[model samples]
Target: MEDQRIVNNEDYAVVLIDGVCHLCQGLTQFIIRRDPAGAFRFASLQSEIGQELLRQGGFDGESTETMILIENGKYYTRSTGALRIARRLRFPWSLSYALILIPPVLRNLVYRWVAKNRYRWFGRSNECMVPTPEIRRRFLS
Candidate 1:
């Protein structure tokens, strides 16, 4: 609820993630490293702002297992969101967007399986990730 006005603008895309999941945190870091232009911003699914964004995008705010990308007023979820994000990344990493050509039903099957096991295989933090001083500005409070 920290003033949702900022999210309405199309200045950048927003990535909503399971902040406590180690894999999700790593993916955020991965995007940051590859995106020097800072075209993406982030929010933890449990945060007030995140839930608001989720609700605005017509998704279930309570579901944290799925990754969501909000761009230009449209929202992409699950594997589609992940691939769309990859499409904006640098070079070879951006090439991963090609996977989007596969059917969503097939792609999401793998995504769902990994999401189900992520907490067990990668472990999660008791609290959401705290962005570093250098990257803190990129996170929505």
Candidate 2:
């Protein structure tokens, strides 16, 4: 699928995450809650569209080492992506974007640790999350 088919650059940002990771799914839910305006859309890293997006971003589609945020025609990965997502969230949550000043090399060190151990700590789903009917529009097929 084409990027435009999933998200219009001016209308929404796309978050690509590990489909079966419990933590990743929870993070999506968290963002949805904080973003009443629904500025973000989601897809699993394992999905075809996600792979295509990854390829377009010059990444290996099979790499699920970090979450990705596609916004304003650019792609950010690791802590930078997380911080950029936070910057778009509501009030107190948006404050987390301040952490961006910490330097990505330092920030990503923590992000990588959590990502590497997420499945062991938070467990995993047998399949990708199926969005509930209420939020179905926020997810890409």
Candidate 3:
């Protein structure tokens, strides 16, 4: 059997996303495309790892509405998490980190608005999309 790897708070960034949301899955695909260096790892909010992390971070899984980025033991939610992930991405994609300059309040307002309607606007998936064999290692199922 493959050994289970325990995530170290400092070495990896854990992305918490909705396992059944189409928009969330698309965003995960987008990140995978841009993160060619294997800089990020993903976990569905419905997964075991995702649940553990959310509990550790004091997040209520039932009401989670934003993606979470956990880095170096700290957690960033909403736009902050999105921007942090962008910052770690490769070249042109990393440019999106610049959005950090916008005030948090403003950024979060936009993020929350989109999050609120994401299900209605983008729909939900019956299950998380399966990653290709090549990139499967990056996902924490």
Candidate 4:
């Protein structure tokens, strides 16, 4: 599958994250910090751009159950998406890709646990966050 991986230079990567989830917000920020070159762009799963991408990618646009990564056109979700994001990030975090060896079912179990309780643990925003001006360029309005 790696052989089929398309470099995302021409097509900016878009990450669809749950808008109100604090954990999702933090993860987006983490990716932004680790990706200074701006290799990735972000959208709230509820946003128009995000919904359009989800529909185009053959996903149920309203489902906020998992993080989605759209790269070059193809989309990845769940644990696969997280691992792929990690692969594009800087060192230490990039090391997370090694977890992909554990099998997706197992990896996703942990991811789902966190996502299921994210609101309880991390709280949530009443609306999608407004990006600070410095990072506004990375968000797909």
lDDT digits (tens) for residues 17-49 of candidate 4: 999899999999999999988889888889977
TM-score of 2: 0.95
Ranking by TM-score: 2, 1, 4, 3
Candidate 2: where is the Cα deviation over 4 Å?
Answer: 4-8
Please give the CA lDDT of all the candidate structures. Answer: 0.90, 0.90, 0.84, 0.84
Off by over 4 Å in 3: 1-9
Candidate ranking (lDDT, best to worst): 2, 1, 4, 3
Using all chains and alpha carbons, the TM-scores for the candidates as numbered come to 0.94, 0.95, 0.89, 0.90
Off by over 4 Å in 1: 1-4
Question: What is the C-alpha lDDT profile of model 2 across 1-141, one tens digit per residue?
Answer: 367555447789999999999999999999999999999999999998888888888999787889999887788999999999999999998999999999888998999999999999999999999988999999987
Ten contiguous residues with the weakest lDDT in model 1: 1-10
Q: What does candidate 1 score on TM?
A: 0.94
- Residue-wise C-alpha lDDT for candidate 3, range 1-141, written one tens digit per residue: 211233454556788899898999999999999887777888888887788878777888774599988776678999999999999988887899999999999999999999999999999988877888997998886
Worst 10 residues of 3 by lDDT: 1-10
| lDDT over C-alpha atoms for residue 54 of model 1 | 83
- Indicate the residue-level lDDT of 10 in model 4: 47
Candidate 2 Cα deviation (angstroms), residue 25: 0.4
What C-alpha RMSD separates each model from the true structure?
A: 1.6, 1.4, 2.8, 4.6
Structure candidate 3, residue pairs in collision: none
Candidate 4 TM-score, C-alpha based: 0.90
